[model samples]
Target chain A: MVFICSVATAQLPINWIDPLNEGVLQGRLADNDITGYNRLPDSVKSVVREPVWALGTNNAGVYVNFKTNAKEIQVRYTVSGALDMPHMPKTGVSGLDLYASNNNGEWYWTPGDYRFKDTITYSFGPVKENSHRIYRLYLPLYNTVTWMEIGVSSDATIEFQKEEESPIIIYGTSIAQGGCASRPGLAWSNLLGRALNTPVINLGFSGNGRLEKPIIDLIANTPSRVIILDCLPNLTGVTPENTERIDSLIQAAVYQLRASQPNTPIVLTDHSSGFNKNILDETDNTLYEQTTQAGLASFEKLKQAGVKNLYHLRNADIALDINSTVDYAHPNDFGMVKISDAYQRLIEQFLR
Target chain B: MVFICSVATAQLPINWIDPLNEGVLQGRLADNDITGYNRLPDSVKSVVREPVWALGTNNAGVYVNFKTNAKEIQVRYTVSGALDMPHMPKTGVSGLDLYASNNNGEWYWTPGDYRFKDTITYSFGPVKENSHRIYRLYLPLYNTVTWMEIGVSSDATIEFQKEEESPIIIYGTSIAQGGCASRPGLAWSNLLGRALNTPVINLGFSGNGRLEKPIIDLIANTPSRVIILDCLPNLTGVTPENTERIDSLIQAAVYQLRASQPNTPIVLTDHSSGFNKNILDETDNTLYEQTTQAGLASFEKLKQAGVKNLYHLRNADIALDINSTVDYAHPNDFGMVKISDAYQRLIEQFLR
Candidate 1:
């Protein structure tokens, strides 16, 4: 390794590595085309719900990691979509968020505000005077990456390690898909991926993240560290009669994921909003209460039915702070960071 | 006073008064139009920077305060413009943020979420069990409010409090303008306003927050608790030849503010992004370094000139964590909260 490092420094703009080729793409969808981040398989694209497939085109929690000693890091990629919404930037434009941690330390954004746009080959360098560091590059949350390249200064060495096979799989809604955040790395799942130093499979389907069998089959195919079901928001506007529909849908997904990887933790999350029944506006809207009720009822039903290793985060505190959310529905970077904190605390027992 | 209380409860949908009409609106421009929100006064509307006046259209830290015994609080208002940026919600569209604290205890958002679009009359209620409470409604950060009405349930009462004339006046960039925040109330200025129980003058012009004579003249007229100048981000990209221009602008703004409000405190903030010179990528941008240099030079020059009551918050921690900002420039709500904490701590000696 030392001899390899000595020779690596002689080459400037150290060799660019496509993480997808290396199989360390954390949030890349399974069975994607040659490009690792096609959002979903073409076969299932027509089957998934509207806005879900289209919005799914944006890569929210996707990321790749490597070790490098170069003082500067650079990226070159083309963002495929521009769904610029006022409430959500993470899912709006073509931009990537870069994070770095040393020797498995805390992650931090590079100092020079490494966000990119028209210029794809962006460099973040003179990093804290460190000889070697682990870097995580997040894809654009609101746009798709066609192809990409990551490189470091000529004098430094870049190393790609083996990939995690049974990575954490997150299945959820738009918020889980990275809504309203400024960058993909700002999404909670990406942050958790780095925080846990584990691979993550983001099955977040934007507006179409409702509990569906076709999607469950996709999730079941992937063995996982943990399966997080954060699909309550997409299950909005349900009527009294439809409660059973939701319960059945959630049950089926759980059973599928559990059957494939029974011992792997299957964690269910309640809608961040609508959980507090005490709020006046939401209580008046029976729709809000119904949503909360449905989520809670599913958890109870699942537990009573002898579903073991089921973890329920009934009330995640990310929604507690009204300010934390970008829009009322999606969390901004601050909320994203907080969500990661909550998940890390909740899942530490299982993952760590 | 007691006689007024008797009749208030007797009436249902207790008098819903427009705080603007009640003369309780604070942080609004000194002279606004019939609607009460002036994105920019006609005089400087064109003279100011492009996004500054456009962004200024969004009310930041502007609020209305009243005491109420009603168990529910409802807001009806129309947001005029929608300058939806993919970056932040606070500065993207029009929305209101509400907060309540009783007997001067902790502050909390009313249960359930209520954001605005075109015609908006949203209610927040079934509040945490409380009889009488102090309510402060924040205007939008990136949009203008045409008109607003605050009402309560039939069984309750609402009373407006006298507005504070000598208020804490904040002058800064979009962060000061509440960028990327889920709500206006999360902005540091608004949070500080509540923490200090003082009305705030939010002159946070977005990309246009640079100190200029025309703007400084406006700030000088107000009898302020303190004048906070947070325009470092706007000063970035300054070339070596332009150091004098920056020095002159910031110095003139400070000296001018001090000239009128002789004893009032004047706080200068450093560029959050450039705080750590140790960062690798930023050192390459000499423009970034020059900007920081210009700010420090002016601060030192003023101090040597024997400027009194001038406080400086050099390298505020808001930029320390990459997660703090929604984009690289504007803070997310958590960062906003942290900024508020730091401000409350630094300004406590002066205001509290």
Candidate 2:
């Protein structure tokens, strides 16, 4: 049977979207609830602190909302950067509640009370029922409070009838993990979800992202719409041997992803600017450019070998300027926006 | 006493002399010694694990022997981002080991074995004796070395030589702390040192460098060449009230520095980039520009009232193209070099 892969040529209309409400859900004890002492319970809340700015979620779920037709349902959210708290503590003694509702306000609660937060990321799958769902993230560490978003996913053509198998997975460094960004919603992956109106699984580890076997194994297991490999910046002072190792690691990861989700798109990126232009010698410049080109070449090679979807972006195309860099390397808020925009544009262009 | 400052100026030519071992010592580790360990105890007669590199010293007392004088010293070295250990460990380690020797052979034994490590930076003290000196760094923990650098300073000029002294204090976010640079040498502050050819105390804290009072107080107490402030990145979600507080904090720090140093210089910098060209909202742009301009204007008002050596670097001046940045915000190596050059030029054109 010759299966024709029809490229979805639907162009989502561009709308003036409001930024996601990337607010910190402060976990404060109720006025009369503290039984042990006068002090309030130290709520383990993820406060978007760096590049401190206000982000609000719009009423529209155009960015993060998704739909499909199947008996069971699956939902996911991207969580990047280091887990604000190390070792998701199980002793907090709070109930782990999943509050999900289709736009119709009909909510479903799990049969048993579950309490697990080990991973920085999560996915709820095979919901056993189908509906137009809007996820509401809630944690009852100290007390339960609803999350406020600066923006939401826009409308899509797909009718909410059943579950869809396709997923989007992002693999990268700190930015993927949400470094220096003000909030989780502002993270590019999350933003990308809002733009595409799909569920994305984020595999961004802070400094620990090295494109190693363990990480690739995780990527291999997940089905995704695209795989973004952004690991160069963290690989500072990487030698030729390590670089080669990374290349192979990427190949291995791509190979695994293909085994599961064939024709999945792959995007590779180089380290952003942190070097001094005045000091770049011809040899160093050539080598650096070659390293970047080689990564792209490899992706192209994969495409040639029938991997249809692959992409590459240079740090230069982003908004980084050495002078503008808050530190010699890390993007300040200004830099983050530029990076997000660049990622947005690329993804949009690719999807188109 | 119409004593001539020219006496000091006449000796400026001495500043051009290479005090390090022909720039060889300027890197993180030298290749001459098979034993990578530098400043190893001479008493140890045998070697088991030969160090990957050797440490070199020059005849001049300055460390690394690049260019130095009795009044100043230059340190250069490479730092491997992929080192086996963390770049700057914060534990029993007081700081990085730094030693100065006028006689190259004497680098083995300098009084107190001055440790350049500080709470958040590498620092040297009041040079007890005024003479030509060579400085050496002993990093005991680093294993897989990549890059090296050297730092220069003259105790007589910045510390001991002055009855009343103020330091050029830099207070800001990670950019001030030298983030994302391949090595410590590539950091803008280190580069700025080479340009100013003077002792500069770096206080760039990584993610924690908020424009807070404790930090401001720390800056206030130090004798400074000038104070360069860049903290908007860390102050992401700051409200008008908090921003006003930050402004007051700057004013207080500057006032205190002036109280001690009297005529020291103070330069303020604003956030370099905002939303990039895509979201070029005039209001946002105006607000960001005005915020920085207001900071400069405030300083100028103080300058008009007889405060000498006060300046501000506009965002336009600091924000270069994306090529200059590694990421959208952090500078690449080339960006570092450019930023260093720009800063040096700015200092030469205005401060000096």
Candidate 3:
């Protein structure tokens, strides 16, 4: 192994590698028609709603894996939208998050300093250790990666690592899409994937993850160890105005998935909101109450029908509080960790 | 009590009230020379370093307190700098964070939807209930507030609330200045203040909070319940290149404060970094180790000199980890909470 003695010499020749050519991309839906680093295949453009199609262009759950001995690494990529949302930081919306495993195989984040522009650049460490190590780079949670290239020192060796198979698949709303995590890696789904030592396919559509038949059909088609439905946030309303519609949507989604993958475990999660605790804000409290009750009722109905491997997770189990969210609707890194802990407790059994 | 019953109507006549006129602004260093919502008095502009003087213009610890019966409250304000930094969000840097105390005196965050532009606007609820309640609005943690106005409904009542006196004062660096909190209220100092039901004077100068005698003298002059020193991050380097300088700075700061206020509790916080746990990154580990050791040595030296009420807080107690930081240097909301817990535990006794 070659060791670069100093971090002071930052002018060392950098060798760029395309992650796609290296076969290091993970959490990408397997499709020949996928033209770039999009969450959905190009073929789905006509099949889904225009909003879903546009959001699909985001690189939400996508990541890349590789092994290298380079003391320092760099990434240059472009994002399609404004770098940030009003509540979310540019780091979570459009920047890269990197983690490396030590010799003991424990994963830890590699701190990076980044610059934002038409083409964003992130530089990660003069790590100072000469041993070859595995690295995972999580892509932007709420933005599209138009193109990306990884750079390593000229003398360092780099190789692609294969992804773990039979991923855990999550179909949910903006929270699942990593609405307001401080960084992409702090997203609950990514945290779960790392902790469980498995892969995850996040089908979290921002503001658009209603329990629709078309999306359910897509999820059923994907092979996975377990499937999670966390779309109650998008389906339930404040007054129970469409309780019947919500129940129908839930039943339809479950039935569709059961038809295609009868043995795969299905987990339904209730909406977790701190608004439920508010005594003064009736509207906020009502929304949380109606949504959670609707979700619980659907789980009970499905269980009575003798649906095997069906599970229910209460809102309380998810562990969200007023202090944990960014905009009272989305989880921050601390809330993400709590949600990840809840999922790991229930889903780790299936992964094992 | 008059209440506007509808949120649908956006054209309700608003009664704009200047917080300065109502005597509601808190956390400003007391001096007749102060002109606006700056943390430091204008008298220090020519006394400190240019960068230190400039950072003092930021409204890091400043907040507004009032009791309002308005169903909805709105703020229109202008900030002096760009809305955000690379790792931090605009919400924490430039947006206002609001909290309301319920009838039982328990404080809870009042969620607000915001629009960012030349004059940033934030709207907080047509809160269905119409009781007069106390509200605290935390200002931007990393931006200078040029001008601000709070608007309530024409028929509503708004009254100024006096701030708690003898605040716990913290003199430190970027973390103490609230670098990467998702919102202004989540800053460790803000969180501690709210939790303790006390006021906080945050004398945190971003990138320039070295323990210089000029700033220490300013802090010494300020009457406080407890004084905390968290400037080790700004003073320490990757290597022990300036160990003697760090020691002298700490000794001088402590001596200067002791000379003025002999009995007030002085707490010194060590640098908290997850890099200390990394097995592969020697540069990161070295930086963490050397800084932490330097801080501990100073604390030991001070204690050996029979300095009464001089306390030292270990780096481990700060509760930061790899997952807690945004860019490894600045703590996110999660890390901020942890650090707040540590400070609350250490300082609560003196406060009581």
Candidate 4:
């Protein structure tokens, strides 16, 4: 095992694994798709529905019975990304749905029902935690999935050392919060999590997402693999002064975070679509472009000043065209998918 | 004066002659343009600072200054379209700004301001009671400038007489309640009012727009030129049964309203965009498309059943593309302008 040391004198073991470059395979499949059954047994359905009705999780578990014989496996996923959070369900939703195939072709089911909770750890059957070959984890929500730490066993024969838990943090306004996602899993962030197979923390506030210091301070405390900054749509009619202030605020936050976690990656994102068109001359487009450019410049300046982990996602033509929007500015689900896919690609290519 | 009594019992008088459309000639100077003057006077600057602070009947005095001998004029404005009776500001904002001018330069300007307290007659200038020759009503906050009734003084003069004072009524969820319009004038309904140069009573209840019978009843009591329905976006995961129930509720309301205002126009609008492209498959798109088609069919039934004034704004391509949206659903300012412009064009051609 390689132990990395931080530049700051604070003595803490640093587990720095390159999330962007590492060989990680993450994905998800719905229960019915995997199990070929639409409804769980009445008893299981009652149990699942009990919690579902008590408190809806944006992406809640849809039970699946695995029927495979693979031996050992590792899994990763992101819980949330750029989707709106308020609309996402909070309690009663389990993160991952894990199923195993013990008696092939015979019915595969859990021995007993487990109550949903914020955190839980478990080992299945006689299989060593590290040696279990075939397993599945159900992810029914977006934005709240914090980490994809591996489940391990003490036995040396079955090696299951949890990977470094550095998360991708998304910061933005309502869209980041998961607005209009009919279900939690449908949010782009969750979709991205399914695509990249990594843990993600959603920090998207509804209308309160301004690049303020307090929020930044909270974010800096998190051990993040990457930080995505997407704001400005909420700052409509914002003048240069306010934009400058926000830029500086972001810069200060990044610097503070860097002081603690030196090479943690940071990616700055701009407001997508709607504001780029020439609806009323170039005023709206110019301002949006200027603010975005200024933000990128600030990030670049930080990089020049020796902040090694910083990048920016430039405005894309697909996101700027008129057809990209549902109304004018807000992305429809299609747009969300496009953005999420873009972020995932960028992170894989650059931050990794 | 020609008072043509039609088959409908409502007996609405139609004198559809618009001054702005009568080759009245517009000037190069726009209302909001900053050309010619390097800087505005202190008073103008101060007023511009709180452009939308004062509104409704109480602040009618402020709009008086917009009247000038200029051919075209532009003004920054904001107006709340939510009805005053059940006084509450909707969660989102909507508005617009545009330049209005007359070629003769003889048009009188008296920043006309008035609130709709119950009902009040609006006559511009000293052209006697209902004798204005050519009047242009500019609603900056509403992003609409329309020509009101003309030709009360002479037969050759173009005239627009309000036979019935029923306004164009809108019913829907948050979008209908005016989400993220930057200002009030940009709302599609408000823009429609400006295009028609007529009074519009907004009954948009934010999240509470559920197509309830009471709301339909409330709208039915008022005199209305048309009814615009846009509500599916708010019904996120409603079951087919609920959708049918809502549709029935709308039909009931329409039935009652048509019974009273027989020939009044009715326009039904469907959800713009919601399907996230990444997750979009044949099933989801088919479901959404089917819902919209069903909605259109229901509206058409009313038209076929002796309702001559019924229309439907097709859903395909009506909403700005998913990319233009700020989130997956709500429209940004640019999206709002696009939608409003589309409605304006549609109404112009249809109402003609």
Top-TM-score structure, candidate number? 3
What is the DockQ score of candidate 3, to 2 decimals?
0.52
The number of the candidate with the highest lDDT is 3
lDDT of 2 by residue, B217-244 (tens): 5455555667777766555433576557
lDDT score of residue A297 within candidate 3: 85
Which tens-of-lDDT digit does each residue in B1-352 have in candidate 4?
A: 1334445334224333343343322211111322221111122333332321122111110111122322212222223343221011111221122212233322222211122322212222222222322333323222122223222222223322221334566776555544544334445554455556545555444455566655565566656666777766654343677557656865876787788778777777766653433211233344555566557667777777766677777655465643233333445444555566666666666665
lDDT tens string, model 2, A152-220?
113322231222434466665555554433223334554455456555555554565566655565566
lDDT for model 3 comes to 0.82
Model 1 lDDT tens row, A191-308 = 7887787778787877778888767777787777888988888887677667877788888888888888879898888777654432334443356557768878988999999999
Error of 3 at A230 (Å): 1.1
DockQ score for model 1: 0.31
lDDT of 1 by residue, B199-264 (tens): 788888777788876678778887888888888778776666577877888788888888898999
Candidate 3 lDDT tens digits, B117-178: 99999989757654646788999999999989999989888887877588788898999999
- Would you list the C-alpha lDDT of every candidate in the order shown? 0.70, 0.42, 0.82, 0.44
Q: What is the lDDT of residue A187 in candidate 1?
A: 77
Global fold similarity of model 4 (TM-score): 0.36
